[model samples]
Target: MRSLEVCKCSKTQAWYLFLVLVVITTLSFTGRVVYLSLGEGYGISLDPSCKPRRHVVFLKTHKTASSTILNILYRYGEARNLTFALPFFDHLGYPQLFKARYVKDFERNPSKEYNIICNHMRFNLPEVRKVMPNQSVYFTILRNPDQVAESSFSYYHDVTPAFREAKSLDRFASRPSTYYSPSAADNHYARNLMWFDLGGDHNAQGDPSYVNSTLQALERAFDLVLLAEYFDESLVLLREALCWPIEDMAYFRLNARLRLSVAPLAPAASSKLRQWNSLDWSLYSRFNRSFWERVARYGAVRMERDVSQLREIRRRLGATCLRGDAPAGAAETVPAEIRPPSFGTAKILGYVLRQDLTGPTRELCTRMVLPESRYLSLLQRKQALIKLPHNMENRL
Candidate 1:
């Protein structure tokens, strides 16, 4: 009873339908367009695509897993042959203040815009904006002050005058005010170091009224405030936010000490550290909640899948790039070029590549584990070569 003949579409009709399907598919992926601007400066386009946002200003906060982040940015930029606005004098020192004059040879160079700025500096929005583009996405990481206090005390013990007289960390923790003085030049490092690094008032830690404004200012200034505790998860969100390839974001934790070398924070000490650095604590706690909310927007299941894939990629890269296994705190496994520094009593482990590695693999492995100071030096030399032709570009 049914009709036997099948009706077929003409070539023109089929092609037109095909074209419409193609466009719909493309829009489905690159469809979502969101412009994020908090009532000023520039708006960033948030959408799905293969292309990544190139311009960024990453505030390298003290002992906040910042070294790892710096390496990631440097490696990515170098691959793209991008420029960095590096500071020559351990960051423009106006006794812990940032000014446009801090950018070395500021008056000489023709183009002020840079691709990335991840140097250690006291953040000043007006001054920082002069170096980066209006569309640049700004971000920074904050760690629990409890851990920061320990690391700062250990790393700067030999350098900071506050830690000079104290025989032990417990002593320094027991009576911080005895050693810490806001007026003392390097005393800034011993107290509210994170607050100081972000250009917040070091003295005003507990006063909610004052500290809240600082927190709100950061909320306005930065696109994201990452929590160091959730580093891998944060990286996943960062990769999505920037539309960067997941491969570009693969990382190995650097500048971490041997577990035995790290002093465990006695709960009492942690509480006191929190109270003493109340402003930083306030910032960290609030940002942490916000960090989670941001991740939730990115979808938790997809985030876990990406993180799993990332961990596996790292595992394979480790096998290819490193010796039998990653250093694992064993000194002999590390190479001299990438060896951990003898910073005080901490046994900071490093990595060594395979002897047989060569070509791009070797270079990639070398940079993956390179020390921060050494990498900066290498970048400076390369940048010098880049500048030699222009003559005027030699300012940095």
Candidate 2:
């Protein structure tokens, strides 16, 4: 009886292994390369013919998980030694419309092509085309208007005149027109900020004809518009579109506010926020549907699997690179140099890497968590050095 049981188990194991091989062969024939780890049950399906895209233009919108996306871009470009269309300072001439000349040294090399342009800028397609290559893939991110308004009110409370005068988000929401003025300095932050960032007039009324035309224009301009609400799923589609390895999309959330600092919007205030930022509301509502449609086309099951894989990749890297819980040790854990600067009442937090890391591993881990300002400075220096020959490199 024991011998009979052992024989049955052996046959079942052999049949399972044979079925696995058959499935893999079928998938391979269908243009997917499946990599399987024996005994681990881990596998990845990738399109072998897809070449990694290099030229990309990420319109870095404010307070919509754009900081995290920028960090990913910074890492990818730096690792590959690609040229960036950097601004003279931290960002391209923002608050003012983006112009080709706004890029540092763009005048000296009018025809120089940059591989990536992921910075805070007022979107201008023609001006952007002047800086990037002809085949660049353009994309941007969006967030729900209510959350954006809440975050903006907190972060720009003191910076924008309207928010400063209103004193609180609730006060501002209750009677927005009373405090908000289109002509006032930094008033853009107080309403329809996302629309303004996208180079649309923040003060535009919610005219159906005008809004529809503007939305259609944006659709024509951007290849993909990601939703911040479905960030992981968005990255899945992004990876497929860019043909990048899932690992390349690994990111740690940066410039996140502490929960205590985040103001709670009452139900009434939340409704008012949507009404006040109606244009931004329409923009978000439109792209949100498109974003899901993209996921459906990408294959819901495939997307779920890829997102799971991405999360695993991020988890492993986070374990290896980051120290403590995220938004960890605001003062003691991270070096003072890499700590993010405070914005209004928003207490932006950063990461701390394990002390034992050294050499290239340490460098990679450090860049993954470096604050935007510090990373920008580092890239500026590196690019500057690259531009100069070895003989004249020291002159700077």
Candidate 3:
């Protein structure tokens, strides 16, 4: 009787443990199902006609309003209940590879498969193909090299450690071999311009031929080409190609910088700039002319119509309203005391930062120390003015 009682107790304990495990597994499965359902339903509306398209890649470039374009693409994916192979970081680096197991994940559960990917990635056709094997569309943008270089110089000067201690554009330009060479630092503009102009490969010795090869490769791979100078038209072409709804093609706003009035370039300065970026300028001018020629062959009127339609769409989408205009009132005017020094260290820094620096010393201030005191006073005065009530009319 004692043996039988012991056996019965052991059987009961085994059954209890099995029941608990079964319940836990059921709960886990239920949670996963709920999560997937929510994710699929996110940003989706009642559009049965909208189907998830697969295998699209966007190669985003710098200073080209790529961020705004990416946002539009992201929204479109969300609305159509599609997934995207988004970048791990806001910008990518190195071997320019995507490690995300997008295909495996899709195969496992088979929820709406991601069809779009927009990231600041290096051009790697092989890596991209690994993720998207089916019929895929690839595209990227190009900007005028001179403008791109100028914008890049300003951007690095303001933001980076390399340019912080340096005092002039001349010094920066002299060291182009440092940043532009194969082993140089990874900067956006230089790297992108080089890759887009030359083929995406980086040989030990920097070669312009690589750029031409890369362009040829891209021409073979991509179905369409977009120019940064004509972004709105490009967007329209993209929308038509994808057959996306008008609402889906609406632009997104991002990364706006204050527009400064550009000074007229001196003849000598212009010549120097041309010399500094000769390879880039040559590549840009050639490609730019070719792009336009291709468009002309397609019909200029159709392009104009597309641009007009995009502008109207932009207005309707409330994108234009986000742009900043010149500040209102006399307060916008610069006070004489706070005006920039006629010659100072900042001027020297600006001069040195230029692509060419062989001009007379008279053009640049010799001062080494920053003009911080004037800048501080200006900041304080601006803060005080801001705090003053709008109704307090002519108190100053």
Instruction: Give the alpha carbon lDDT tens digit for every residue of 1-396 in model 2.
Output: 755543554455545546655644432211011111110233354599978889999999988999989998888877667788999998899999999999998998788878999999999989998998888888999998889999998898888999998999999999999998889888898899899999898898888999999999999989999988888988888887788767777778888887888878999999998899999999999999999888888888888888888787677667767777565735654677778788898887777888887656566667777889988998887676446332222222
lDDT of 3 by residue, 1-396 (tens): 755543554454545546645543432212222222223322212245544345678877665656557656654453333546543334334344444332323333334344776666666666566566457777766676555655555555544433443444445455544434444354334433544423354332336685566557767777666777877767766665565544455553343233442223445544555565565555456567766776776568877765665555444323222222222121222333222232111121111112232222111111111122332233223323323232222221
Give all candidates' CA lDDT scores: 0.73, 0.81, 0.47
What ranking emerges by lDDT with the best candidate at the front? 2, 1, 3
Where in model 3 is the C-alpha error above 4 Å? 1-54, 94-113, 158-162, 165-171, 174-184, 187-209, 261-283, 319-396
Prediction 3 global C-alpha lDDT: 0.47
Model 1 regions more than 4 Å off: 1-50, 89-95, 328-334, 388-396
Q: Give the higher-TM-score candidate: 1 or 2.
A: 2
Looking at model 1, the pairs that clash are none
Q: Which model is ahead, 1 or 2, in terms of lDDT?
A: 2
Tell me, by TM-score, which candidate is best: 2
List model 1 lDDT by residue over 218-334, tens digit each: 999999888888888888888776677666666777888777777877877677777778887788888989999998897889778777766766776677678767565637645
Range of the 10 consecutive residues with the lowest summed lDDT in candidate 3: 361-370
Cα displacement (Å) at residue 112, model 3: 9.8
Off by over 4 Å in 2: 1-44, 389-396
Better of 1 and 3 by TM-score: 1
